[model samples]
Target: MSVTVIRPADRAAWLDARRQDVTASVAAAVLNVHPYTSQYQLWAEKTGRLSPDGEATDAMMRGVYIEPVGVAMLRDQKPEWAVEYHADNAYYRDEKIRIGATPDAFAVDPGREGRGNVQIKSASESAFKDYWIDPDTKQVIPPTWIALQAITEARLTGCDWACVALVVITWRGTLRLYVIDIPLIERHWVAIKTGVAEFWRVVDAGEHPPIDWEKDGSTVLDVYRDSYTDVRDLSDDAALDVIIRRYKEAKELESSGKKLADTLKPQIIFALGNSAAGKTASYDIRASTQIRASYVASESQSRVLRIKPRRDHDVDASRF
Candidate 1:
């Protein structure tokens, strides 16, 4: 499969190129499966409506420094395979669908005509134990978002398979390597293309996707940061009416719960006045103090939604 190779001269070039096409990194966003980026946020960024703050994240920095180590460790662990590392900034794009990928490394099986691509990731010990491995099944599965990224990269690179080359960094200053091979699902590619097509269609038509309330709340707030001194009568919105009612009820419960907890904490502390630890019928409580690092928070204003009642109603929506 012949694809276009883009060797970026600098990070700016790479970012610019990434914005032009649906790269493998943000492919999961198109499918609404990515945890970090929502479809709305991706659209906002791609459409130049929202410009991401030009700051490199800690994970991004870690990957930049640990990627070579990850690929090297993978080579050492898989002795039978030939690992090939390419230019870090080389992006391969398929013109057919305008989908592109920047692979971490490529793996070749020696004495065989088979090749696969590797997606390198640096995971903390806790993250590996909690998320990388299935709690119930005890099977290790990389994040679906990253797995999709690897699959898309493999397909774009003309490879047979894709695998996640994970580098688990422990707090004990020890490292662990796991190369989990991902089986190819042909339908996944089809779904990816379909999702990407829909995204591009909306982009061309200047349409915004419906808000993913769960994942896109922060994105919406960030993209539309300005808050004007305006009030509108949203009483006609039945959905918002119910939502606000639930929110108020929940807030009341939270206030009462906090009061109860605060009252109990003093009683428990008094009971444990003479002792540092106390045991109840089903609970063991201990009193302890730890020093915390203090730092000044950055100055920024976040939008707050406040609902004021226009009229009093005795009707209970929750009961209905």
Candidate 2:
């Protein structure tokens, strides 16, 4: 279904429009596998069980400051493509599913074939280094999670394509900018929007979606952290009894594991002496170190010992 676009002036209006709808930022979470925020966390927030983003991180503040810079750089570098800033967030609604999105900004080209949206991102020096790609080539690769968000915005806006402007802060505090063009894929948007629709349905029903135990376990634990405000003894439920037993066993196993590791750590370190590596028939252990600048110490060096199986070794997997 086509989306309805709204340009609301007030912040409250924009926020109200976003309520109960799947916005671009959490679109990845709806489908799971967002790099940072978990789907369960998003679910909790939407269901009004938890309030998140109460305190913005340092990175968030940095993004706020760098957003204008991104907009300015794009306009200066590409004069033909006029970039217009939205004073308030733009809202889009798919009436069928009640899903919506807001892009960072929109491109104002009088003669363009289809509408275009813009996304601005900022990262720290280390992160930028890890994700850096050559923007000059058509082969420029966007970060997966953020790309999903930008594409979701494009889908809501009925745009054929979108542009992402990435800005990074260097170690010396200088800003670097890269621009990438992303074309919309119908199949991807269909899957994302459909998944989001179902997710919102779960929220409206006051129920949780199917949980990926390994992925959502920590979120579930946090959600129930204060579930029992006061402890009281009661008749035992069979499930609770089994859980208590397992918990005791887990604690014992953890203590044993730590003790064993501690006992062996000194012996291994001492045996290494001045050697950086040790080799066995089936395994190799290496000591690696690095020096880097630190905010508190000015400079620091750290070392770690890593162990791995020999490249050609065929170890028995079932012997654990």
Candidate 3:
């Protein structure tokens, strides 16, 4: 595949290169499945709106420092693999897509008898424990997001495989290579290409990807912290109206459920006086008291709901 190359002289140049095109590292974000990065962040980065400063977290620095060690380890395992680092940004563009990839190492004439791209990663002990694999038993458990990243790079470089090398550092300062394997999943490559093209279309149209409140909570909090200074009441937006109506209905249901539970609780508790729990044909119920410290009162006693075995029961339409 023909690609445009941009050689970055330093970190600043590298950051600038990233702004010019979507890189393999951010492919998962474009797919809306990246653990740390949200779709909004990826859009901002690709659109040149996000600042490069403060982009490097402590873990990122650890990865940068440990990458060379990882490369050395990978070389030790496969002495015949010719590994070379690329300081230039590799970008491929066409009518529907503009993508970039900067591989950590490119292996040529490897012992595996195939050329491939190598990506090095460093993760915390907790995170590292998740990447363990067994070549003997053929058990491979890898992080999906990072695996997608390597696959995206392979797609861009026209390589059939990607070697993923990871350095896992423990809290006690121990380091280990938890996994080193070439993952060449065809389905991942196809999904990545399709998702990137979709993201590019969104960029071309000057629109943002839909925010996922559940997944984007941290990013939203960071961006809106002590902000929203020029806030104005929104007019009757139909989309927002749907959300608001659903929210209202949910709250009403919650209130009614709570009221019905309150009405049922005292009667059930009276029947099972001094007994901790009771079971019926339809349900198993338990009552427990909890004492919690509150600001208004030194200590407050509250009933704890402990219900289980929620079997199916017919609803009475006449009651409704």
Best model number under lDDT: 1
Question: TM-scores of the models, in the given order?
Answer: 0.73, 0.68, 0.64
Which residue pairs clash in candidate 1? none
lDDT of each: 0.72, 0.65, 0.62
Per TM-score, the best of the predicted structures is 1
Candidate 1 TM-score, true structure as reference: 0.73
What local lDDT does model 3 show for residue 198?
86
lDDT of 3 at 168: 73
- lDDT for each residue of candidate 3 in 201-220, tens digit (9 for 90 to 100): 88889987876555543343
Per-candidate RMSD, Å: 12.7, 14.0, 14.0
**Structural RMSD, model 1:** 12.7
With candidate 3 superimposed using the best TM-score fit, by how many Å does residue 244's alpha carbon deviate from the native? Answer: 9.6
* lDDT for 175 (candidate 2): 78
